[model samples]
Target: MTIRDTVIRTLAHTNWRLALPALVLTCGSLIVQAASEDPEVVVPTASPTTAAINPAGVVTPAPGTAADAASGVVKAPIAAVAPPTAPQAPAPVDEPLMKLPVNARHMLVIDDTGRVLMAKDADTVVPIASLTKLMTAMVVLDAGQDMNEEIRIEDADVDRLKHSRSRVRVGATMTREAALELALISSENRAASALARHFPGGLAAYEAAVAAKIRALGLTHTSLADPTGLSPANTSTAAEVARIAAAAARYPAIARISSDKSSAVEINGRPRELRNTNHLVGAKGWDIRLSKTGYTEEAGRCLAMRMKSGGQTITVILLDADGSAQRLRDAAAIRKSLAKIAAA
Candidate 1:
């Protein structure tokens, strides 16, 4: 069957939850095969692209978006969905997109007054990488389990889907709070996995809550398949990502943990220093309140930060930057430029 027809049949015939991996596999295989046959086609990576997956865990691309070319979902880009009008907060005073470094698929800068200083592709949906953990942390907190409760990492927490390795071992145990701290501070996939595994009913339940929270928060474009963001299906737009950064900053622990430069933690009875994934957090003259960085061959490099500069606070989001260094450079440039602008 064709990718589109297979997807249609998967939706109509089987339990969608179980069919996602198959869908991702088939679609990715087909796309790669086609790309190899066409010499002119330049696929970024031979592995199936993350955009090859979606909320349903299926490889069908949401038409017209970046993922379309990857997953073979050929169609016009979907128009922006206008949400029901509500009491409008004053829009942030608009500013122009200043000179920015390349490799950014989407970028947004929103200031304290709700002014959008600069934005590009803010509405474009894309894979968010481990930024999904911010919501995972929130959901874990919402469950109201004792942060001090003890939990152990297991084989299941290992990234079987991606086969990504982890510093936290299969049998090591720690307080739920520690796992959470590691998740936010270091973007540890195993830490995130363990946190979800320890959730009331476990990872499946945690994932369900994540989906619910996305809908509840009116994050219309965000979709999460797993807590660790190992699943390429974990996706969101730059606009929704900024909103998530704001909400995540509201949690004292999230704000504190994410902004901490580094912390010492014990895993497998050995002391290890867990450092913030976003280097801008500790860079001189930069005041980051909450930050998270994520990267995968599929999603590229991503960053979300609530930065405080002078008297103004802004959420700066960069998604799918070409490399780690480029994303940081883009952020630092933004801060310096904005600070100069505000001073003037």
Candidate 2:
């Protein structure tokens, strides 16, 4: 082996190695150029400008218009809507009747149309006591005399009970209207008897008028022996008393006068404020249109009312209750029953 032969073999090996590296560098340069020319990928330049590219590789605003300098309008993300709040539960109702400590002997409730809603011995006759004054006022109103006419209290008007309350003294003069007001509002026995005595046909015919009115109103279980219910003979049932309340409600004046809780009237030429015996008229929960309360040893405590409850009109009559508290409780019981029925 000479030196020349050794050099030629080495040079050929070196050329083979250089040819492989040159081929790899050419392929890499071509790949990079191709990627740069692709329209989908855009490289940002040094100029203070942004390009808008759609999803499909389309460029907008042609690179130099006002839109190219201004930022694109960004769509705001939608906010999630909140669900509605849950409905609240109804408030609990208190039962006033359940708090009463006494029981009543007879009770009844009727609709404004005279249809019975509830009854407990409603048809059994019981002494009506002072409830007779309701019919007495009805008789006086029917007598066709001027309400402003004056009448003098006589000895007959005074109650035999020495300590009993009275608005009129013997020989004192008061108008018919004032007397009727005192009679209905305060349950004044003297005013009632005075009105009866001054009726067109006097006391006897006045009693007849009361009976006739009871008959005309179709109150079959009612009987009247006196203008004031002081006479134990004046007796009626709860059903009949409810009918009387309905009939009285027909007369606006009677209804207005009966429901008045308090009023000022002249007695013996002085102003006397008369308070109603029926507490339901002035009670907070009652919308009383007509009302009357009665009490006697024979009748106990009695109450009748035309009232609105639970958006419906009703008549309530409580007879021979043990006390005033019991009569009020009876009324509250009927109201509670009606409310329950309405809710159902």
lDDT of 1 by residue, 197-252 (tens): 88899777887888887776667788888888878889888778877777777788
Task: Give each model a TM-score.
Answer: 0.72, 0.68
**Local distance difference test, each candidate:** 0.76, 0.71
Model 2: per-residue Cα lDDT over 27-116, one tens digit each: 566677778978987543222222232332111211232221122111123457989889765323223222222256766555544444
Quote the lDDT for 22 in model 1: 89
Off by over 4 Å in 2: 1-102, 161-163
lDDT of 2 at 70: 22
Question: Candidate 1 at 57: error in angstroms?
Answer: 27
Query: Which candidate has the highest lDDT of all?
Result: 1
Clash-forming residue pairs, model 2: none
